[model samples]
Target: MKYLYGLLALYLASWLFTLPADALQQGFFFWRGQLVQLSGALLIALLAALLLMATRPRWLEQRLGGLDHLYLLHKWCGIGAAGLVVLHWLLSKSPRWLIQWGWLTPGARHAHQGASWRGLGMELGELAFYGMLLLVIISLVQALPYGRFRLIHKLGAVLGLMAGLHSLILLSDPLRNTPFGWLTQLACLLVLVAALWSLLGRIGRARRVTGQLEVVSHPAPDLVELAIRLPRAFTRDYQPGQFALLTLDAREGAHPFTILRQDPDTGLTHFAIKGLGDHTRQLVQGCRAGQRVWAEGPYGRFVLPDEGATPQLWIAGGIGITPFFAWLEALARQGQTRCHTRLIYCVERPEEVLHGERLRQLARKSGVALEIHTRQQQGLLDPRPLFTDPQAQCWFCGPQGLGECLASALPAGRLHHERFAFR
Candidate 1:
């Protein structure tokens, strides 16, 4: 949220600094031009930020609180860019409509040296705007399949480069002399670099490792468990609750899944994926033993905090229980039996509950109280009944609605939740 506010403040400052002294007195046409300039600057800044975020830099992820928070910010950046595009279009084109309606008269144009270049810039800008608009719309629509959504999302890089070219060519003389212009130029260059990197399919390449699937099993109708054996030379370590991006098929792209188990002795990494989307469904159907796959990550900050003996409540819904499963394994391996922990596992049906016996075994060995809830039998879970200790911290990994409901029932800073879905 601070990052979001900082971007807004930057936009405001740039707009104020670039505005002319007689911006208002110069007439509606002059104000329109200023407004377009301001919107264009803001759009470029947001586009640059989106590209940087796409790179998934680890430092930025930590500084921004987590990759989840980064995605939230990325979402807002897309929305803001879309809004600014609309604003710039209206400001620059409304004068024609006003004149046609006889509400205002046409104003004289200022002569510029690079009129031909500016005309080309305007054409590029218009093309970029429409392309961006389509991309943004497709992204916002939840009904759009993930496969198509992912492919469409990459177009932002292309349109971003075009927008950068447009900005460089059409920048006003006054803006070109100011620090704001220099910053804008820097942003454009970064956007171009990011776009190229994305197009090259080299995102997060350094962290990636190739492995062979040793086991693929179906724990339930919609759930799949995968174990991959990496080469002995591979040396990536992951916290229990972290997730990784797996690329099974080049055309399908990489998808994020929580690391359910990691066996250091055997060099085997495990992941549990539920068939919730097209990609996941494909993974469940096509994945097999001896299949080669790529994984890049060990990303996420959802691991348990080192709060000694503080009573903790762990809640999971459906496949959201994946991370908690990892945490339980870590606890069992470490023999941390003194921590007072309560786990609430919720599912629609008893059959849908994954690793029920294993969870209970781990809980007993680690001295944790476990509660299983079946929606059909027990109805919805009420967190109010479970909040017996005010000092206890609650960790949730579930649907957004469930998290929101629990957050409302608990005190601020007392509840932490995992956000795995990024849009």
Candidate 2:
């Protein structure tokens, strides 16, 4: 958030510096100039950040904390960009509205030769704004099927390119030779390049590796487990709590799934997916033993404590238990028992628990105390009794409302969780 606001302030300062010194005293039209520049600079900054995240740069992923954090930031940028587009629209059309109400008269300055080019820029900008707004609306509708959502979301790249062209056409003439002018042009260039990269489907391309499904089974109702064998080691270093974007079928596109188990020697990875959505249901039903797969990532930073790190409290709700399995498996491989960690699994029913036996055995092997709470057995969770020590680190992956409730009750640095809901 600091980085985002700092960048905005920097851009605002640059644009403000370029404005006429007497801008405040120059009346409505002059103030309008300042307002439009403000809106334009901020809009460009938001789109630049948004498009950059679409590229999924590893360096950016690290700087932003993780791919999970990156997704949250990307969401905010999109929302801000959408609001700014509306602001810009109002600013652009208000003059005509004012004139219609006979409140402001058009001067000879409004009839200049450059007006034609500026009009063209405004037209293009309006079109881009509409395109973006439509996509944003589609994204906000949670009812949209995941497969259809993935397909429609690709149009974001096209809208970003449109916005870039709009920025280029509307750049002010007086600022053409200035450093700020070059900065504005650079923003447009970045937007265009990033859009093209996304449109070409180059995101996470380097980390992607081919694999084949070796085992697919259902242990519980609506639960499907996949064991895939890769031909080579992952492109990026694999971690226990990290996840991969698996392309089970090209038509359904790639979806993020937490790695339940990964064997570096054999290059075998496991994913336990719950059929909560239509796309995931398709994946569960369509998965086959010999089906080809594309795995891109091993992304995320959620990990248990090292030898000297702080003790952690692990909380998993329903399908959220997936990553903890890998953590336990990793600990077992290192022959490290008596690890200072505790895991609490919460589910509505005992039958809904995934890998109940394997989870208990792994927890015992790893020397972590395990607690399973079901609505019928233990009622809903009471987070207060759970957090006995305020200094202990807490890691939660679960339903959003419950996570938020737990987060508020924990200390600032004690709570850690990934934003798994990608949309």
Highest TM-score scorer: 2
Clashes per prediction?
Answer: 0, 0
Tell me the deviation in Å of residue 423 in model 2.
Answer: 0.9
What digit string (tens of lDDT, one per residue) describes model 1 on residues 73-96?
Answer: 899899989999988888878999
Badly placed stretches (over 4 Å) of model 2 are 110-119, 264-266, 307-310
Question: How do the residues 238-353 of candidate 2 rate in per-residue lDDT, one tens digit apiece?
Answer: 87888889898788888899988876666678899988877788777878899899998878887655745656788998888887888888888988875678899998889988
How many pairs of residues collide in model 2?
0
Q: Tell me the whole-model lDDT of each prediction, alpha carbons only.
A: 0.84, 0.83
Sliding window of 10 residues with minimal summed lDDT for model 1 = 230-239
TM-score of 2: 0.94
